[model samples]
Structure formats: structure tokens, C-alpha cells
Target chain A: MGEFELIRRFFDRGDRAADGVVKGIGDDCAVLAPTPGWQWLVSTDMLVEGRHFLSTVDPERLGHKALAVNLSDLAACGARPRAFFLALALPRADAKFLEGFARGLFALADAHGIALAGGDTTAGPLNVCITVMGEAPQGQVLLRSGARAGDELWVSGTLGDARLALEVFRGTHSLPGDQFVQVRRAMELPQPRLALGQALRGIASSAIDVSDGLGGDLGHVLKASGVGAEVYFNALPRSAILAGQDLMLQQQCLLAGGDDYELVFTAAPEHHEAVKDAGARTGTRVTRVGRIRTEPGLDVLDSDGAPMAVLLASFDHFKS
Target chain B: MGEFELIRRFFDRGDRAADGVVKGIGDDCAVLAPTPGWQWLVSTDMLVEGRHFLSTVDPERLGHKALAVNLSDLAACGARPRAFFLALALPRADAKFLEGFARGLFALADAHGIALAGGDTTAGPLNVCITVMGEAPQGQVLLRSGARAGDELWVSGTLGDARLALEVFRGTHSLPGDQFVQVRRAMELPQPRLALGQALRGIASSAIDVSDGLGGDLGHVLKASGVGAEVYFNALPRSAILAGQDLMLQQQCLLAGGDDYELVFTAAPEHHEAVKDAGARTGTRVTRVGRIRTEPGLDVLDSDGAPMAVLLASFDHFKS
Candidate 1:
């Protein structure tokens, strides 16, 4: 199939009635009418085969993960998903692959009420780059620089399951068939905490998505806000499969392994009940994992309140 | 170096003072404050190494072309340049390549006053995907669907030189050293017609950028507007080197040559002088090339006003 025909068949859905999308899909440029008082949020992510996912990954799940990663950025900023543009480079026009990929992609977009506004497609080695555009009210959008001393840090959902799945894939760890399936799902299909982020907009002082594991991503919030943190190592939440592992393995996965897609946020001590209320409203499990500190460096503390030393460096695509 | 350090050193510029940028580069998502009552325009383009340019092409030109192609889409919609997001995948982090690339990319961005907001970087085969965000007032943006049956077709600047340059590179044709340099520049560095597009917004009924050859790109406008057109074949503008070629070669290059990055648009006959004034105001060379008809297909007429037929198929990435 030709490029235009392929796009028309698979990607261009003509029934988009998205609120801010004045024009979608068929134009030289997609036109968006922004909500009057809202600030627009933009983010882009590029996923490559082998580097980002296994060659054997299901096309549907690949599609889901591509948009999921980009949406995670918006959720971290307390932005409501509005629309997205995809620029895809493929090896060929595989009909079966396109069908399953579109199905998985649009399913998540529909669930979030976000529209596939426009994109570009070409023949090349397989690559998926998604740029998501969203909106939040002015002065209400969350940022990394909002944290300060005396704020309590929190996280939504569990972490490390995705990394555990990766370890199994790498032959460094193994799990029973059913348990492997569970962790694999966590790695393949991540649900963005859009509602939890929106709910915590005013209550939380700062927020970030845990894409590069908790340690490295939290370091971003600290470096940006110029504040230190004290993470309670034992308080870090995990899946049952991970909790069953040894302490060192658990710390390795939970602290420095990548692709968690959970929100790490901070709020003042007085708003502890408010943060809990937000978690309840969004049906998310919010855990108090750390607190903002006046000092200038991170402290990962054990149950004894003493810092434990480990070189828990996160995954760096180039240097790793 | 790590991914964060790579981004900070190359892509992240801390001095962005663009009008509507609330936050840039460091946040989870770049925040943009849109101009009230103006509609936002978005477009994306992906350029792969072998497909889009020669592997030996300069890295600086590669960077410029990457963003330039996306900006062309916004120009076609008559939107003012605002900001862009880049998603880059590289085989390795070569510091020299990045420095030249950033220099060229930022030069054009500075010329257009667009900010490099936020994006992703990963290790893979080289790929550059850019998403540009622009703006035009509501109801003022030109669209392909706006052309009328009696409108006169127009094109800005020149066409076909880029293809001539490609022919030389492919060993299909040859040119003198000086002529080759001129045409090669056309292929390597295309200037998007931002000012002319904005100038023609109220005057032109429809507009499109000539990327996939004039014939195919014009087909999109005709298909969208539900109209046909008659091209004065001999009147199609060409560079001096292209004009010196034989008739058949000239016809192939002028009709179906891709990567011209020029604007093809339509305006009512009553606004001919106004169109000229817009061209003059923007310092662009605008030429009247054809007229839109109520009929359902495109017709290329010779100087004798007879339909002369030769296969002039435009470039399609997959099929070609």
C-alpha cells in the first residue's frame, strides 16, 4: 500500500469530535482551538526497537506503550489529555501490524478522550515518535520546580514490576508462567495516572512521572526545585512478585530500574489528608515514600533511619 | 555522558524568550500559553537517513532540513511560526555531529523566532522527527478545502532544482560544478515560505506545500476542494539550470519533482493585483500557473491548449 492510503485506512479516524480539535487528520496542519484560560502542555518521546522494546513484542502492545509513555508526561504535569501527533517510521506497510497497532492505540486514546489529531508516516527502520498536547488552567499546572523544604513526598501505584519483567526477559531472573504474565503486563501496558494528577494539582507542590525509575526521576524534581529528599527505603511499594525477592534485588528493581510510569509528587505535611483524599477519589493507591529536606542531596533511609549506601544509578540509554 | 547531560549540552537552550512559552526544556512537559482568540496549528514530519538525504550529507544541513520540512506544513496553513518539539534517535552520541546539528537547527529557529521546547533522545539508527506548533487567527487560516471553481492557481518562488540535484547524486544526470552546487543547495537547504503564506492568508483561497512533487501535492488540494485545475504547462517556473534541460527531463522535474518546499495556492481572479501585492510585500516571486475548474480532475495543457500526456508519476516512498 502507498503511504497516503496506509494512513487513510489505519490512522485517520474521520469521526473525531474532540473538543479543541478544530481540524484533524486530513489538513496540512491540524487546527486546535485552545480553551480560553488554559495553558497548553507539549511533550514528545521516541521509542526504538531493541533500545525501547523487544522485536518480539506484540504490535498492539507496542502501539499502546508508544502513546502511553508520552501521555505519562502530561499526567506528571497535571494536564488533561487533549490530542496527539504521531510520526512513525516503519520497515514496510504491514497490514496486519497496522491493524492491531491502530486498535490498541485508539482504544487508549478513546479511554482518555484524547484525539489523534495529525501525524507523518514514512518507510524506514521501525520507530515510533509521539508528541502529545494537553492543557491545564494557568497557575494550576504542576511543575518540577514547585517542591520546597518540609513537603512530604508521595507516589501513585506500585513500582519495579516493569523492571522485574525486564530482568526476566534478560535471563537474569525467572518467574512462574502466571507471575511472569502479570509483570509483563505491567511492562507492556502502563496506565497513566491522569486522574490522580489532576486531582492532586492544587494539593501537590510538585510532580514527575517515574519513567527512569524512582531514584533518577526524583533526582530531577530535587535538582529543579533545589531541594533534597529522604526516601524511606522500606516504605517503597512493590508487587508481590518483587516483594518475595531478596532485599538487594528488590532495591535494585524498585530504586533504579526503568519504565514504572507512576507519579512521584510532593505536598506539604498539612495536606497529607488531602493527598489521601485525592488518591481515594482517583481510585489509586498513594504511598508516602519520602519527604522533602533542607539538605542538598538525596538520602535513601532504611527502617533504622540511617542512610544505606548503594550505587543505585538509573538506566541511561547512551552511557549504560 | 548520560542522556540528561546530552540533552542539556546540545538541545536545551536556557535563553528562550519567545512570547508564549511559560516553561521550556527542563519540565516533564513544556508549557505554552496560547494567544487568546487565536487557533493553534500543528504538524509533524519524520526524516530518516537514507530515505530523506544522502548518508554523507552534512549534519548541519540534516538538522536544518528536519525542522524545515515540518515548518513547511505550518506555512501551508498560513500559521505564524511559534515553537517546535524534536524527537531524535541516534546510533551513538557523537558530540561533534550534535554541535553542528544544533548550530544549524538553532540558526533557523532563531531566524523564525521559534523555540525548541522539549523532546526525547534515544540510542538507535538515526531518525529525526519534528513536531511544530504555530498559530493563526480563527477563520483566517488558509486551507486546501477553501478553493473555488473560478479561482486562479499560483505558486511561489521556484521548483524542480532539488530533483535535478538528486539526479546528479544518483548518477542519472550531470551538471557543471557551479550549477551542481546551486541545485545541491536547493536540495539540502529549503527555505519555508512563512512570510508569503501569512501574507496570502486573506487573499489566497487555498494553499499547500510542494513536498511530494507539485502534481501529487496539488492533487491533495484538488481532492479536498472538490475541484479540478488546468495547468499552463510551459509557464511552470524553473531555475536556470532546470530550464536548460531537454523538454522531457524538464517536464519530469517540474511536474513531479519532490522536496521543492515552495507554496502552491489559489486566489480569485478579482484579487490578482492583491495577490501580487502580497508577493511584493513578502519579497516572494509569485506566478500565475493555472485555473481551478468545476470538473473533477487535473489537466496539464500545452502552449497549443491541447492535453499532452507523458507519465509524470510523483514520488511515493513505499511504491517507489
Candidate 2:
């Protein structure tokens, strides 16, 4: 069987046509109806083997993470994911690998009621590129340029566990077996803050997903919004496992290490209760880490209100 | 500079927001308003380094072709091009390659009036993945399953030259420099039949873009429609460069060799005049090379109306 037939049997959600997808797989294009007065939210992410992931990583988690990262982008926009198209390049079409990948992909897709749309499959170096389409009411879409000076900066869920797991996998650090499992889960299966994002549509002025670390991603929001930020490193959220690590390691992972998919957003201080309520409704922990400033550059602060400096940096694909 | 910064400086269309986009780059997601009451047509195509193209190919053409292929998918669905997101992974961020690639990509985007939405840049083996979004009025979207048993199978533009060009490139055959140029353009820089596809929406019953050769793609229509087709080899359209080739080479390229990117469609025989008008309106040549049959299998007929057999097969990534 060729790539098309294989996809038809395993990956294609043909039944989606009955569930709002005007057209699903097998067509040259998948078609869906947009909610009237809603804006389509688009995000594309490419994950390459050996660079974004390891060969040792199981295919199931790989598939989940591939779609989740793109979904995180939608979450940051306060958009509800409606569908996604996956362009996958496999070194070979091993049946075992395909089964695990599709299961993990459909599992996340089913939970979100997102349809698998259309894409191409090819044989080459292993890579997964997914383009997610979501929607938000017109004028309600969150944007990075919406942040203003004096806004409180808040982040959803814990940070640094994904990066901490990476260090452990790289042999730069070691953790007990149970701790390893916790961190690995954080790295492998990120639950994007979709509910929290939707609830913060009007409450949050600007938002970004923490993919390239809290410090770097927040820098983007500040840069785009023509403002700066002062993030109190001590106020940063970390999982119990990460909190138990060395102080410097915890600081490094929380501030500079990447692959966190939590939402970092800005809200007026007056909306603090609203932010907390949204987090509570979403069942996610929210932390107030800092405030947006009128200054031109970012500043990291310690608990003593003193400037803090660190050598670690957010992941830069080209620079790295 | 980081990947995001490089992308912003070179590829981001910040001004597109003033046109129709609610939000553009530097944001977590791009927000676009789809025309109300239209179905969103989504398609994605991935081009790998070694599997899809050669390292020696020009980067400019590579970029154009990458987007063109995805656009072709939209065309097959009779969708009008709107915007596309590009997720490009590069082995290294070479300045010259990026410039040429961007120039070619933007030129095509400008010609089609399609916006570059949002995508992530990453470091990895060279690969290009593009997701194109288009729109078609609900219920007017043409589908493969719409083909009827008595429909006349039609194809837009000339074919087979692309496959002929591939053989020349592979050093398996040789052609005059002028003939080589004609065929090479067919292979490297195919013009997707977008206008024709849109025009054929109401006239054509079903359509598919010929990426994997006429036989295989036609098979998709047959399978989806639960019908069969009998293609007349002598009636297949070919460019002068391809027509002058040996009989076997002509057969192989015309029947099995891929990457044509032309649209193959089915229209009722009674709508011949309407199909012709669509072709005329779109400035594309339409050829009737086959007829859909109620039989269970595809057939190839020689000039004498006798069964013809050959050893050519459509491009299949894993098998190839």
C-alpha cells in the first residue's frame, strides 16, 4: 500500500464529514464551515527529528506533542481549535510506528473535538509539521500587541519541568525514578491551557505560549506591545520536582529552558480576581510573576528587589 | 538573531493585517476573517530534502513549487486561494538562499493575492511544509465522490513533460538543451490550474490535481465515486517535447511519471459546452482523454482501441 492508502486506513478521519467537517481526508482539500462573525486563527509548527525531539522518544507521545504545540499557539490567542492538518515525513512506513502515532493523535483530537483535515505523507527524514485552525469571535482574538504598561504578568500552570526533564535526558542531571516520570510527563504530554485562554479573552490584554521559556516568550509580548517587563525569578512557578532541585537549576529551567507550553499573559492588576477565577474554572494553577513596564527592556528581579543575572538563555533554533 | 527575528525581518507580512488579517506575525496565532457562508478549504503539502527534490535544485523554484503544490490542492476543491502558513526547517540559515526563496514565494503569493499567515521556523534538515487556506461556497464545493459513471474524464493543460524532465535530470536520458528547458520548467515550476479549477466548480463533477500521474489520481476519483475509467492513450495531451520522445518513454511519462500539478476532472458529457466555456474563461486547455464507466476496474486503450499494458507506476514514496 502507498502512503495515501495507509493514511486512509489509519490516520484519515473519514467520519468527520458527519461531524461538521464539510470534507475530510481523501479530498485534495478538507473543508469546514467557519462560525459566522468568527475569525479563523492559524498556527503552523514544524518538529524535526533529533532537533526538536529524540529518536528514543516513543511515537505516541511524539504525535501528541506535535499537535499540542500548535494547539498551544491557538490557546494563546484564546481560540478554540476546530481542526488540524498534519504533514508527516517518515523514514519508513513501519506499521507499528504508524499505529501508535495515529492513536495518540486521535486521542487528543477527540478530546478537543478537532477534526483531522488534509495533509501529505512522504518518506524522508522523520519530521512532523502540523497546522492548526481555530476560531474566536471577531475583535475578541487575543494578541501580543495588546499588552500595556502596568499590566500584571501571569503564567498558567507550572514552568521548567519540561526543560528539567530534558536536562535529565541529556545526562546533565539525574532524578529519582518517580521524579523522572513526573518531569518526563510534563515534557512529553503538555496539556495546553485552552480553557484558561478562552476565559481570559477579554480579561488578558496579551498572551503567548511558553515554548521558548518564560523569559524569552514574555520578551516577545513586551517587545510587540512596546513595553518591558520585570519578572521576579522567585515568584516563578515550578513543579514540586523542579522546586526540589538546586536553586540555580530551578532558576535556569524556569527562566531560560524551553518547551513549556503554558500560557504567559498580561492583565490589569484590577483583574487579578478574574484571572484567578478563570484559572480555577480551568483547573489550572496561575501565578503572578511580574508586571509589564514602560521601560524598553526586560529585567529579572530577585525576591529582594535586586537585579538578577543568569547565563542560561531561551532556545534559539538558528543561534543554538 | 533568532529564528523568529529572522522570519520577521525577511518573511513576515506585517502589513497584511490592514487588509483582512485581524492579527499577524509576532503573535501566537494569525487571525483571519473568512468570507461568511463559505467553507474553509485547507490543504498541506510537505517537501523533504532528498525524497522530493535534489540539493542541486534552485532554491527559488523550490520555494515557488512548494507553495504551488499546496495551492493545487485548493484548486482541485474549487477553492479560491486566501492565505498560507509556511513551516520551513533549514539546515543552515544562509542569507542568499533565504532571499531567493522569499522572492519566489512572495512573487507567487502576490500573483494569487494570498497572504503569508503565521508559522514557526526551526533548525533541521532542509524541508518545506506549507498549509494553504482557501474558500468555496458551501454546497458548491466539488468533490471526488460527485463523479458519475457516464461522466467524461477531462484534464487541464498538457502533462507528461514533467516526468520526461525528471528522467533527463536523473541522467537516464538526454534531450536537446532547448527541449530540456521546456520539460524542466514543467517539472520544476508548474503553474497550478487555480483559475481553471475555480471556473470548473459548477461545470465539473469531480476533480483532482495530477501530482502522482493521471492513472493513480484518476483512480482516486474512480474509487471515491465507485466507478471506473477507460483512458485513451492516443488522446492524452502532451507537450511537443514529450510527443517527440520514444513510444515507451512517452507512455511511461504520460501514464505513470508524476509532478504534473495539472487538474484532472470529470464532467457530464452533456455539459461539454459548459466545460469548454470554463476552460476558455480560465485561459486553460482542457482535454477529454477518458470516460467514466460502471465497470469495476480501470482500462487503458491504445490507438486501435485494444488493451495496452506497460510497466510504469505512479510515484509512491515508500516504494520509491
List, residue by residue over B1-320, the lDDT tens digit for candidate 1. 77888999999886446778889899889999999999999999999988998899899998899888889999999999988998889899999999989988998898888999888899999999999999999999999998899999999999999999999999999999999999999999999999999998889999999998999899999999999999999889999899999988888888899999999999999999999999999899999999999998888999999987955578888898
Query: RMSD for each model, in Å, please?
Result: 0.9, 1.6
Instruction: Put down candidate 1 lDDT per residue, A3-32, tens digits, no spaces.
Output: 889999999887347888988998899999
Q: Is the docking of candidate 1 incorrect, acceptable, medium or high quality?
A: high
Enumerate residue pairs that collide in model 1. none
lDDT of 2 by residue, B103-217 (tens): 8888888888788877778888888999988899988887888888899989889989988988988899999999999889888898988898899878899999999988888
Per-prediction DockQ, in order?
0.92, 0.83
How does residue B227 of candidate 2 score in lDDT?
A: 95
Worst 10 residues of 1 chain A by lDDT: A13-22
